[model samples]
Target: MGAMDVVLVHGIFDNGAVFRRLADALADAGHRCWVPALKPADGRTGIEDLVAKLHAYIDRHLGSDAEVALVGFRMGCIVSRYYLQMRDGVRRTKALNVATGPDPEVGDAPKPTLSTSGC
Candidate 1:
């Protein structure tokens, strides 16, 4: 397929830099990708804050009629879900991709619960 615009979201305790390799690959394949760093990324950011950041990024960067796809990794999935469902996202969203993985530990990580719905 031809080049497409995309946003790559990082997981908790991680920053946008983590997507460097994947971003390079996407660039090589002719896709425009952005890996924006979200605040409180060290597994302590509240879900609401992350959601707000995502919404602001889209509002400020994307055009009114722009069609873009979302690719959220791990905790990012939850952020994307909330954005699409509660922020009038379907109008501009072309596709949504979410990647989830099993938690490696529950040891000292903050235990936060989340519930979301989206198309």
Candidate 2:
């Protein structure tokens, strides 16, 4: 595919700096990458709050109409999922790449089906 707008999300206990190398590589490859540092990385503020912050970040930086590819690591995967499933993100998300650890929120839950054919 051509150059895409990509958002890289860091895990709990980490910040956007963690994706510096990956962002550099993606940028060098002509992709527009945004690595946002979600505050309260410890997650004491809750995942929904983090998702809200992510939503605002995307709105501010990428606009609501831009199609984006999401890359999430560890706890960020969970945040990304919430954004996709509950925040209308599937409408504008071109792809999702999740590198996640064990997630209690997903354990034993039915898998969600996301339609991206029109994205």
Candidate 3:
């Protein structure tokens, strides 16, 4: 496959830097990766804020490039789900929820309950 641009969004308590290894691996496989830094500071930001931030970032960086995919971890996955509900132009997007669940605002999607089984 040819090179395609990728956008990686990290979960709470972590930044885009968290995806460095994964992005590198993808790059090695001939795909361009973009792991934008979302706010990692605790209590200062929330998932809604992140969704807006990521949307703007994708618009700015990818800009009409539909050959893009997303890798969202944990809370990032929630953001991606909402984005997917809202985003209409992107051609491809993959959401990887490392340890997470549906967005609270998604309503009726069954908010996930925490357990030892993992987030």
Candidate 4:
């Protein structure tokens, strides 16, 4: 497949730097990658705020009509979900890959998995 746009969202207490390796690999594979640092990574600012930031970032950098695949880690999964489900992001999202972390309900995190749904 031709190069596709991919946005990597880091986990809590982390920044875009955390995706350096993955971004490099994706770049080598001919995919365009964008790792945006969501501030207040601790989530004190709330997921909705982060989602809004994510939406604005995508719109500014990739444009509102561009299609993208989202890779979210830890708390980023929550933010991504909000963006996709609550913000009408599913319309432009090509895929959703999640790297889960500790969960209060599950008691333990599940293995990392990539979940994708057609837009």
Candidate 5:
């Protein structure tokens, strides 16, 4: 298989430097890893801005043919999930490796349909 592209998105109050070990390991294994620092912002505005930033970073670095993976913590998971929902063709991203909230109650709350291929 070709080299895989991995995108590491840090959680609130944290920065991309948090992924140094993981990024180093992935790169050692021949995969391309990215952990661009999410630009600082206020609580409310940061979410969407971070998501857009991640999306743009992925597009600029990985291109269309590369597989994209996300690693986020806490509120970062929500941001990553929201981005995954809106992004097309790029299905199956990894979540929960970092801290996150309770798993959604599928029936009680609206849930997005994720493709059953990759994670």
Candidate 6:
């Protein structure tokens, strides 16, 4: 299969700069990648702010037809979910990787139908 576009979201104490090597590797592999910094006050800022920034960056950098895979490290996972749920942007996103964090229990929570096909 062809490579999918991806956006890297950083966690606390970082600003997407940490994903530089990963981004470069992805780019070199022919997949479009972006590492936009979404700074918060070291967990002081709300997730909404970060989510909004994520949406803005995607809208401005990626076109409307772009479908990307979101890879989040630590708190960035929370930010990714908010953007996917609140903005209903899941349809435009291919996958979400919630790494370096605890996995959430979305089975009981009210959200979109997440199945193994996309898993």
Best by lDDT: 2
lDDT of 4 by residue, 1-119 (tens): 46789999889999998899999999999899998889989999888889999999999999999999998899888788778877788888878877874453563333323356421
Evaluate model 1: give its lDDT.
0.71
Q: Which one wins by TM-score: 1 or 6?
A: 6
The better-scoring model by lDDT among 4 and 5 is 4
Provide the overall lDDT of each model, using Cα atoms, as 2-decimal numbers.
0.71, 0.83, 0.63, 0.82, 0.63, 0.75
Q: Relative to the unseen true structure, what is the Cα RMSD of model 6?
A: 3.1
Error of 3 at 101 (Å): 4.9
Top-TM-score candidate index: 2
Candidate 3 least-lDDT 10 residues: 110-119
Candidate 6 residue-wise lDDT at 51: 84
Per-residue CA lDDT of candidate 6, range 5-101, in tens?
Answer: 7888888778878788988988888888888888762767777788888899998999766888888788777777777888676878887776775
Better of 3 and 6 by TM-score: 6
Candidates ranked by lDDT, best first? 2, 4, 6, 1, 3, 5
- What does candidate 2's lDDT look like per residue over 7-65, in tens digits? 99899999999899988999999999998889999999988899999999999999989
Clashing pairs in 1: none
Clashes of each: 0, 0, 0, 0, 0, 0
Tell me the TM-score of model 2.
Answer: 0.88
Residues 1-119, model 5: lDDT tens digits: 44566677777777877778988988898877788777772345756677788777777777755566666665566666667776542353532243463365532322445532222
The estimated TM-scores of all candidates read 0.77, 0.88, 0.70, 0.85, 0.72, 0.82
Query: What digit string (tens of lDDT, one per residue) describes model 3 on residues 17-37?
Result: 778888788888888888887
Once superposed on the true structure, which residue ranges of model 2 sit more than 4 Å away at CA?
103-105, 108-110, 115-119
